[model samples]
Target: MKHSGSLLIVDDNPDILIAARLLLKQHYQSVKTTDNPFDIAGIINEQRKLEQPIDVILLDMNFTQDSISGKEGFYWLKKIIEQDANIVVLLMTAYGDIQLAVDAIKAGASDFIAKPWQNEQLLGAVTAAFSHAKDKQQVGKLTRQKQGLNQALNTPNFEFLGQSNAMQQVFSTIEKAAQTDANILITGESGTGKELTAHAIHQASMRHSQTFMSLDMGAVAQNLFESELFGHKKGAFTDAKADHIGKFELAQGGSLFLDELGNLPLEHQAKLLAALQNRQITPVGSSKAVDIDIRLICATNDNLDQAVSEGRFRQDLLYRINTVEIRLPALRERSDGIPLLANYYLKHFAQKYKRSLTISDDDMSALCQYAWPGNVRELAHAIERAVILTEGDKLDISSVVGNSASVSTDEKTQSTEVLNNVAQYDTFDLDILEQRTVRAALKHHQGNVSHAAKALGLTRGAMYRRLEKYGL
Candidate 1:
């Protein structure tokens, strides 16, 4: 088969150079030969300057007189690689010096062939090496194109208010982490706006323009976790009808928010830890690994240290994700920011619903005083509901305070019951427990499926299915 790639042959022997050049010239488009190995650098440089660089190099391992150790071959290989590392360097050695040839390959040579090789064997190796170089070039081009597209697309913007000192500190840490490419772990109780903070960091960071993909780890099934995080090829599994780009691949050059991370089981944590540590992922049903470039931001309501002690979370994975840990203050703790958040939600909902609604001082006090087990999320729902239902200009405190207490009480009771069931029954129906947990989360977030899903460390799709299953 004829190859389009150019070739460079370097050897100390005139006969070997002439014979190899004559043999390879028929198979390749351009073949350059040099008997002095010292002149290989100049030859490669000239080729590079001409914009017709050699694609593959056939280098004799023992180029110096009385040099059977192949040190000269290794030195020239290093020089060639330094000039252009992408070029394939195939080493040639005497038939009796096969080990030396193999060692040269280990040092940097791409491949090795013995002297007096079959013409067909030489031709086949060069073709294969040329094919690999072309494939690498094509892949590099595609990666650049995809990265350009990802950076060009518009990403959603978010604004975070942090009037309270606790929140101000959170903002300060966020600014620090945003400047550097650090994997961040945001921790707090439910409804603390971990996801919002993640968006804030992404919007303010250097990768602000790239995609910000969010995945709820808890919502994904155990079997599909790999497919969801690292992607899967077509025919990877029974349901993998088409190729899929996992969150890690999709969030290239940007941020990936793995919400509810503590929900990942121990078995799955190993897979996640491996991908993160290696900075690469192999899609399901594919042996080839794809390199990933991402800034990770993860959120978890669970205390990871406690979970690690209990054997629910991996210690190594914990260390990997939390390069910089930022704890967001719960709503009750940030009293100063409550009014701002409340009014923001009120104004937003009022305009969205086309209503004239204003918060009363008494109502603001009620919002500030509430325990807010659901944090800002519960408060936002209270404000939005009041905006939708209240007819008068000034919204009263009764609706929010009254409904919140009842819902909070109900959630507590339901949680206590579930804990009791788990502690008492050896074979309790998991469906019933899941239903109760879903209901409590929904009630806690005031029937907002998305918020409730976050509170439950589940994906919205997963929460929706349960809502239907339990007929909530």
Candidate 2:
């Protein structure tokens, strides 16, 4: 197999350099030989200039004639490490001993090799050294990437809080699922805290101390999907000026949250599936495939099953990502949960804005009654907005009730008139009430489904179903 690693063999004896080069050249992508030890620094610098640093170095212990103390090898070893501490160095000498090997290793040499080594032994040693060097390089690269992404990794401090039966079941599932390395798929409506749930799982998992990298598939351009998820080499494309570590590598030994997975293009789903199935990824413009150890957690607001049936999604990919599926209920479906979330965000935003604020019992009741189409995220935003706008100590229901938004007095009067007109029939039948309410809302909103849905405390999907049911 062709290797992407580079090897450098340095020996004072021309014959040794020639022989080692000839043998290692077949296995390594780049192999350099020099009979002069002084050329080591120059050669290494040149490789760095080309962005292909040496992976392993075979150094002779006695570079000068009649010198056998191996101090020369130790000197160069220190220099190599000084240049790049992660580079693997192997010491070679004609006069070899167990003590020399011990001393060489203690001085940071990867291994000790005796002169006139067998080809198989030399190949084995170099291969092992190259692997070790690659590992170190990967770790260093990930550390740097983590430093760069530290600012973007601002995870929220709140847990997924809900007391309704649906939320209680979700909490139970999260606790159980976090115990294993199984891939988790969080399905929910938009603004339902899918990303937050992913964070909760990562925090609850054994890999809590490690990274929790999140990528919003919906926000990423389709053309950049592979590069964004699997990473890319420096100069991989017109804009790839530097090597970029993908989310998979950054989330090594942790959780990788792929938000909006259903938005992934069908053509790109195969690439993701291949990586997950193989447990490895080949960066764009690079032939080497890197093995990754990450617990995968994906979230989506779209109905993937319907998409799959419509041929917009792949069934196999769906199966691969949904080993444990946790669907978050819509805000309206979470019975008595809105008040809890609203109060939580109220206190949170109140402190954030440095204001003392409280929600009245009546206003809180109105908040509990309205259907939060935007879910917890919307509720948080609404509370924050109220906290910022309300000048009084107590929150005003004028802005917090009926869709959790500020509606003009005229609009409120018109909507109440519509509801009152619909209730004038005096029929206590729920179906009749629902049909009349849907019609009235649609009329009041000028046939705008979104506005009508929000005013009626219903999701767009629920609104559409009602429209279809009542033939409105």
Q: Report, for every candidate in turn, its global Cα lDDT versus the true structure.
A: 0.77, 0.82
How large an RMSD does model 1 have?
15.3
lDDT of each residue in 1-472, candidate 1, tens digit only = 6667779988878888888888888878789998887888788657654546678898887866776776777888888777666678888877436577567768877678887889888888888878877875567546644654463354432257769989889888988899989899999987788888989889879998888888878678889999988877655688875456788888898888898888888899999989998999988877788999999999998899999999999999999999999999877678778888888888877888998878766556557666676677667777777777787788754566664322354553454344334535443466787788888888888878888885554546556667878899
Backbone collisions counted per model:
0, 0
Predicted candidate 2 versus true structure: per-residue lDDT over 296-395, tens digit per residue: 9998878999999999999999999999999999887884887788888888888888999887765665676555556776577667767887888987
Say which candidate scores most in TM-score: 2
- Which regions of candidate 2 fall more than 4 Å away from where they truly are? 1-143, 148-152, 402-472
Indicate the TM-score of model 1.
Answer: 0.59
Each candidate: RMSD to true structure? 15.3, 12.0
Displacement of residue 206 (Cα, Å) in model 2 is 2.3
**What's the CA error at residue 246 for candidate 2, in Å?**
0.6
Q: Judged by lDDT, which candidate is best?
A: 2
